[model samples]
Target chain A: SAVISQKPSRDICQRGTSLTIQCQVDSQVTMMFWYRQQPGQSLTLIATANQGSEATYESGFVIDKFPISRPNLTFSTLTVSNMSPEDSSIYLCSVGRDFTEAFFGQGTRLTVV
Target chain B: QQQVKQSPQSLIVQKGGISIINCAYENTAFDYFPWYQQFPGKGPALLIAIRPDVSEKKEGRFTISFNKSAKQFSLHIMDSQPGDSATYFCAATMGDAGNMLTFGGGTRLMVKP
Candidate 1:
């Protein structure tokens, strides 16, 4: 299993502002994923980030709202742009090393005010 | 459409009892099924997983039962303890290059002593 570290454990952002969450893996990996978990709800895949390529966003999510950056194999970032109350949720960074199993970071809890 | 659906949004089990969570998937292409556990203020962690080729998989006290014809899978936790209390999520993926996942609505399990 890979050890993932995500920053800002939590943050309170004002409406119209943006918050960028960072993810760092202990070892090199091929793919990293971003997810959003609303309170008392299931997790929704936001995007798939591959090294040296543009992140692929899932349906109902767009890059403009949740832009991702994968600078290398072990690091990635997800920025929630133009925050709103509806956008408040827990953002998680996940890495799948063996393709079958995934490891996750502690996640960043964002609250829009 | 929600590709994966989980039942019993919340569950309460006594210590040393059995805890069961069920999930079903609508996408036939999904070949991989995984169960994740998440505590408050933490990201979801992969607890166990199974492939459609198998009927069941077990690790410690956690077990995953898969039924291909019904497109359903379930997680069973035996000898429940308070430390096992957490939110459980069932997820499915196609086992392809992207390995994009679709998650079911979570089940919050509370094991009382």
Candidate 2:
């Protein structure tokens, strides 16, 4: 199992500010993903961070809002740009090697005020 | 479009009893099904998983029952304890999809002592 470490476990940001959450994995992985969990809601996929390539955003999500960066197999970052009250949610990073269970980071709880 | 659907938004189970959560998916392309457990202020952890070819998979007190024909799966927790109280989510993914997962609306389980 891979061990993932996410920074900024919790944060409070102004409505117009942007925050970048980092994720570091103890081991190399083939795929990395980012998800959002709103209060009392299910986890939603934000994007697939491909190393050396642009992230693939899911429907209803775009790069302008959630920019993701995967510099290597062991690290990735997600930036919530132009935040708003609706942007408050828990951001999570996940890493996987193959067709197996993926490991998740502790998650970053962002509260936009 | 919500590809995955879950039932029983919340449930309460007595200690030593059984806790069950159900999920269904519309996409047959999903070949991997996994359940996750999450406590407040933390990331979700993979609990148990099963493939489409398997009818059931059990690990200790956790079990996953999969019905490929019905496109449904369920998680069962035996000998439930107070510590078992947490939010559970069911997710599905396709191997070729770069491990992108589709998650169901999580179920909050509260095991009373």
Candidate 3:
């Protein structure tokens, strides 16, 4: 199991602004993922962040909207760009070690007003 | 299309009773199945997992039953307790896919005392 720490547990952002969430892992990992969980809904994978490479994004999400930075094996960041009401959701960071199971951070709750 | 389907968007179980949640996947390439538990204001945590080679995996009070031919799996919680009340999600990922998980619609379980 990995210990993940995410910042800004809850925040209120104005529309058209951007919020960047950070994820730090206690142990080095090869794969870090960003996810969005809408209220009362399932989680949707936003992108896969690998150290020293461009993040691979899923359909319906793009780098322009959710720019990701994985500077090293233990740290990553996800920025919600040009926020809107629909962008309000809980953003999660997860790390996969050995492809067996993934460990998750506490999550960041963003409310775009 | 939703790659994974889950039943019973919400569930209510009496304390000490059994709680069951079912999930089915359409992608045959998915070889890993994991169950996640999330509480309010927290990210989803991996509860239990199973592989295609295994029929069942049990950890403490939680068990995962896998039917490879049916492309289905289920999670069973025995002796439900109020502390177990939370949102549960079923997810699948293909081996070597960087562990990018495709998640099912979540089930909110409430265990009453």
Please, what is the TM-score per model? 0.96, 0.97, 0.97
- Which of candidates 1 and 3 reaches a greater lDDT? 3
lDDT of residue A67 for candidate 3: 99
RMSD of each: 1.2, 1.1, 1.1
Candidate 1 lDDT over residue span B1-113, tens digit each: 24899988999999999999999999888888999999998888889999999999999999999999999999999999999999999998876744467889999999999
The most accurate candidate by DockQ is: 3
lDDT tens digits, residue span A5-89, model 3? 9998989999999999999999999999999998889999999999989999989999999999999999999999999999999
Residue A104 CA displacement from its true place in model 1, Å: 0.8
Q: DockQ of each model against the real complex?
A: 0.67, 0.71, 0.73
Fnat of each prediction?
Answer: 0.65, 0.65, 0.74
lDDT at position B99, candidate 2: 66
Model 2: DockQ score: 0.71
Q: For candidate 2, give the lDDT of residue B15.
A: 96
- Candidate 1 lDDT over A41-89, as tens digits, reads 8889899999998998888999999999999999999999999999999
Rank by DockQ, highest first. Answer: 3, 2, 1
Of candidates 3 and 1, the better by TM-score: 3
Query: In model 3, what is the error at residue B32, expressed in angstroms?
Result: 0.9
* Predicted structure 2, TM vs. truth: 0.97
Compose the digit string of candidate 2's lDDT tens values, residues B12-83. 999999999999999998889989999998899998889999899999999999999999999999999999
